[model samples]
Target chain A: MLKKSGTTLIEIMIALFVLASAMIPIASIMGYGGRATSKDARRILAMQLLDKTLRQMLQADYDEIPIGKNIQNGFEGIALGDVTAGQDKGFSFNISLDSEYVNPVKFKYRGVGVNRPTFKADSPVGDDFLPEETISLNDVVIKLTVTVTWNEQQNLPVSVSAMTYRADFQRRTG
Target chain B: MHYLDAKRSGMALIIVLTLATGILILGISYINTIRKQSGRNTIELGAIQADLLAEGLTQIAMLKFKEIPGPLYYAYIAHVKGNTSQPYSVYHGDAILGGKLDSPFNAEFRTTFQLLSSKMYQDMNVKITVEVEVSRPDGEKYQRLIERTVSGSRRPAF
Candidate 1:
């Protein structure tokens, strides 16, 4: 009888091939996870900075809202001090203001009856002929737009914006 | 006997394949779990930040309201209401507090007070709303709105 031998080299090679195939995908997945986590962390930091800037804007006086062109390193024309040097240090932002008063609408009442008795006389009369109109409310309505820009991973640019409205209304006096 | 040897080798091959597959599945599952956890954490952090900002702005507005006298406060309201075209007076954080930090992040805040209703010889109620927007150096933005209602005497008792 012939003596039985140990496993062949071919078997060892096949086993290694299977193991390598399985490990390759797993390693790639882990690498993907690491990169995603890093990106998310940067995003969170950026969001925090944005929130802080917005809070500062809300604390400002209404009349002092910077309007028209972008205002840099200042709030309402006042120097922001060292905050404006954000670019040199890490981050920076711009605030722009656009304002307009909302217009009120008015409806005119037209007589239902026409001068002529004919049912289809020329044109319809009364309310049918009335036209809708818009009038200015004369109240101050201001829109403040704030944009913040920063860099991610030291290269990619990231930015976020927020807008709010301020309208003037009557105040009661005792 | 040859048939038995062949059967044993086939069994070994199946066992090895099964073990490899199990490890692969587990690793993929773990990675997916980690990814989900990170996403959840980020969202929670954002929500908390927004809430804190809104609360802070409300406090600042309340403090400003306390500092001004009633007559002047009323006048300020009138001016803002009457002049729709011209810009109204606004408080600047750096200017009011002084010695503000020079940070890379920038912030702009707008607070407005609206008189709700009032009666002569009675307390006057006003609604104060604060809007804030913050910008980061990387161009990220966050915004919040805070509102409060406060009542004060038309004229100071003192």
Candidate 2:
């Protein structure tokens, strides 16, 4: 009876060994999946923050907008201290503006005008190719770039950047 | 005694097989869940990209309007042709202008403008609508629409 029981115990041990061998790879795969999902979530959040900042900059008055780095926080409504209280809690962003004044006449005259063969009164060809009206006021084109940075699951740094241009033009009445 | 030993070994084998199969199924389910989640993320990203592209295109259209001499004439022509209600394809290509998303995706933009009645003879009310569509590498599509009314003094050239 003692010999029989020993043989049964050995069989159970072998079965457990096979089961454990299969589990390690499965567990690792799950871990990898978890990490990937977390990373994607953080990336989406960063993109949202960047988009918000860009829109705010575009809506602001051209004269009111400030130039330089770290002028506006990406999170407008959220408090900075609250966002930075804990580790990996939130994100930070910086907005920078580059402005250049363009002469409408110089810009227009430089273009080589090519009349489209299929031009119709109602259907115009590409606007880029069309002759633009000369603006009385010099055009101030502002390029705004917003960069957002955040920490991932393992404190891995991730960043997203977006850029847009705002043209400062107002109609002049005689 | 031999038969009893054989029966005990058979039961152990069955238990192991069951445990292994269960683990395999669990792993597969987890993988499927992850795949679905990843797809969702891709769709979300595509939507956001489309929105940004639409916004950028609208700004471009506005800039173009400002540059053109006869903004009201163009708006009136578009309205007369009934194109203002429908989207008119302006640009279609894979160019990443001033926006995020480093990956080059297919982009198409359509614009239309309508002329609004104004009390001031010099001032013209033009409502421009822009639509942008972006396609992801995975064959997913997203679209966005934006409209803005721009009122400005008409140039004499118009």
Number of backbone-clashing residue pairs for each candidate, in the order shown: 37, 3
lDDT of each candidate versus the true structure = 0.49, 0.57
- Residue-level lDDT tens digits of model 1 in B84-151: 21112322221311122133335556656665665424666768776656655445556767788987
**Candidate 2 chain A minimal-lDDT segment of 10 residues:** A105-114
**Chain A alone, TM-score per model:** 0.51, 0.60
Give candidate 2's whole-model lDDT. Answer: 0.57
Docking class of 1: incorrect
After TM-score superposition, the amount by which residue A113's alpha carbon in candidate 1 deviates from its true location, in angstroms, is 35
| DockQ by candidate, in order | 0.07, 0.24
Q: How displaced is residue B100 in candidate 1, in Å?
A: 36
Off by over 4 Å in 2: A66-138, A151-157, A169-174, B1-8, B60-71, B74-106, B116-124, B137-139, B149-158
